[model samples]
Target: MADKRDYYEILELGKNASEDEIKKAYRKLARQYHPDVNKAADAETKFKEVKEAYDVLSDSGKRATYDQYGHVDPNQGFGGGGAGDFSGGFGDIFDMFFGGGGGRRDPNAPQRGNDLQYTMTIEFKEAIFGKETEITIPRTESCDTCHGSGAKPGTKPETCSVCKGSGQQEVVQNTPFGRMVNRRACTNCSGSGRIIKDKCGTCHGAGKVKRQRKINVRIPAGVDEGAQIRLSGEGEAGQRGGPAGDLYIVIRVKSHEFFEREGDDIYCEVPLTFAQAALGDEIEIPTLTEKVKLKIPAGTQTGTYFRLKGKGVPRLRGYGQGDQHVKVTVVTPTNLTEDQKELLRQFAGVAGESTSEHHESIFEKMKRAFRGD
Candidate 1:
């Protein structure tokens, strides 16, 4: 007892420190020395010591005992609560940590199940529209062999003599706080207030079994990569007779060979022959649904843009659809024959080679505007 470090020294606070000050010091030290956050060799031991210090100092009754006697007895309820301070009302904290294990939880309560997530990869076109998918997930279900009671078939579970089927036990201790009542879950019956003398051969003793279940998921339109679709009540079965949780389907859209997307808009590059660009041509272009004829204007140059309204992805949340923007690239004829070269040379000699006099490029337009032409 004498070899133990003073609780105040462990928290780096003085004996005259207030309750709030002690709480702040303890929280800071707890966060700094917590085993999960700090990987030092002594972190876990330091965390336990810090928790012990906070447990005593946070309680007015235990702190008084420690101040006078220099040590608070563990068996006398010194470090029972710091994190477990249920002074306001026991209902909130009691339900959280113990899941209402203290003489409260009904044997047939409907506890909520766990939430699950599954990643799915889909085609680019399917994301632009939508797709119906079925996935399989592993879940925990109540054992059919024992009917969730963990007892063998044809034999009922015996009543627990420890808690007398009430699932609770009263613990009375005398400390500086006077006589205190601390009720806990019965250990022998595991707070169920029932003893399974005969276990199910299939399940051994566990009341649940792991099962693979198939679930249907609906992927909405315009759902991008990393989008999540939630299916309610599709997760693991809850403990006892609880309700099922939600299942989240995370989307992974595959890359498209022809198109790229940004927010609501779609962009694509299409190649056009120089003659088809110069003289207007009705070209076949691919849309989400079908190939359509796109009319290219006469004298259309490279980098010309065309818009197909409502031809891209459908809106995921709003009223209308997005437009597809196509950039035209006029491909020059490659590997020209001698006759083709001679024809081009003769045509260039007669024609005005300047783009401003012919079909003006974007750069030429910009220069003309800048020079006030």
Candidate 2:
């Protein structure tokens, strides 16, 4: 028990996390660590840890007990209540939802197909304006020849004589409390309750085939990175004529070379010459759509930000657009000619050491600071 990890920490949630938050975290982590999806060695272990945490936190009674005393003995209950009163653990809960424990399941029952996920990377501008494209995916589909029956064409499936079509077998176990009967899938029929004498050639008796499918996807305007788009009935083929599952597309937005976005606002830096910073000029600035003229004020300091309204990214929510911020950096003149140097020296002599109130320079401020003024 001392080596066990905290439930909240396992789910990456706080102690006061809501039920919805706990469930959401569980679903995300489960998908990330599912054995079918992730082939890593530790994926199954991580998935089990996530499932155990969710099992305890999902039940109110169990959650309260865990909150009070962390990681109690599995065979014992709180204050010696005994294991029988503990109400099933993770296996029981999983069985209840996935059709494994308690009652017998029909082998021919419809089971939903497994959901699928695809990650797509788009340009940063594409995220701002959005685009529509087609994607190819490999997925499983029901066999056309057997019509999802797993039997050969023109033939039908026969019921399993072992379990009497119940698809389950009863195992009686004697415990300290009493005798318990547990239901398990029939070994003869493999839980299908039907036997295929002549298997389908196309599907190899599996009742499904793999094929490449092309799907069209539409990305909405102003979609950010890590956003998801869902496509209904686009996952793997279901079993026993069940409905197909959905497909999830996760977005990955590529970085832009010129612009950096925060929320809807855009930021960029532009270089200005010393003459342009001192005498102010109308310079051309690049926007998302086209070039726009920006007026730099006289005596503008380096790192001064200028905002261009409605020049940033479009809003994903209600209305309008965001502003673009431009930071100007003054570039000093270099490799000056003798004539230009003499002219600057004469201009500096006339300017003297005095600094103007409205047009203060960083050098003047530093000098005044050194003099303790």
Candidate 3:
């Protein structure tokens, strides 16, 4: 019989190697001495020896037992009961580290459900004022027949035989340093450690199915585009008994026609007639609220602005409201009748003298310029 070497010494690690370090060392060694890759006479036996070392050292309980007794024998308390007994706690550790030892499966663990995202477009007005809207999204939901178990209603899953319920497979490797061991997830059971003998017909053994669902969402006022709203527990159903994921509703607001928004303020251009610009008048202007009258002061010039207090969109977070800025654009008359032309001519003759302060100031400056002062 080959000498029974200390498991830790075979893997070139200390007795207190961390789980990550042990797993890393095992992967490196197993790849080197794998029988498929190495054809030497003692390659197979060396591989098995490396596997046995890793199988014990990778597990805390098994390592503790080996540490106390100097050997892990089936006769030892809670040991795997000799080689290939498949009852040792090492199997569970192997499954966890290697994904699933190529083995049998366990059936009773809860799995998390898949998450879903839905895009929703809302009108600008609706987004600013808040509205309740309905949305439809395609997603995977839990199967009603199997209750997300993937197994038939009355049936249960069985442990995988390949990994012997350990969910991992052991392999040996040879490296420049020496021989080593490796552990990997079982190919047969994946990493779950269980398999469904009879799959659920409703979900076709997937535990979930694609379906269109209708959800009602209440978009709060002042919500901007690209804002995401999360609805908890509304995504795909979890496998086995795991909790469901959340549904993320991404919002997209449409652009408005006449009004442009900046933060909480609303901006718009209001055209003013020549009469309104020259002879100040109070004119009705459109706002988010009903039309409000704005006073145009005498001698108001084009491009002048008027503000309506509390007439803009409501602030999204803070108190109070933004003011509506109305940019006045003076519109000159185009078509003139013969009578209108004659009247304008008479008015121009009467207005020959400078009456406005600006024109008077310009005339005085010109006189000084001519006098060289």
Q: Residues 45-69, candidate 2: write the lDDT tens digits.
A: 7876787788788888888888877
- In terms of lDDT, the best-performing candidate is 2
| Model 1 TM | 0.66
TM-score of each: 0.66, 0.67, 0.63
Q: Candidate 3 residues 115-196, lDDT tens each?
A: 7888888888887788888888888888888877678989977888887666667765554324444566778878666787
RMSD of each: 8.3, 11.8, 11.2
Candidate 2 clashes: the total is 0
Q: What TM-score does candidate 3 get on C-alpha atoms?
A: 0.63
Q: Which candidate has the top score in TM-score?
A: 2
- What is the model-wide C-alpha lDDT for candidate 3? 0.73
Task: Report the number of backbone clashes for model 3.
Answer: 24
In Å, residue 214's CA in model 1 sits off its true spot by 2.8
| TM-score of candidate 2 versus the correct structure, residues matched by position | 0.67
RMSD value for candidate 1: 8.3
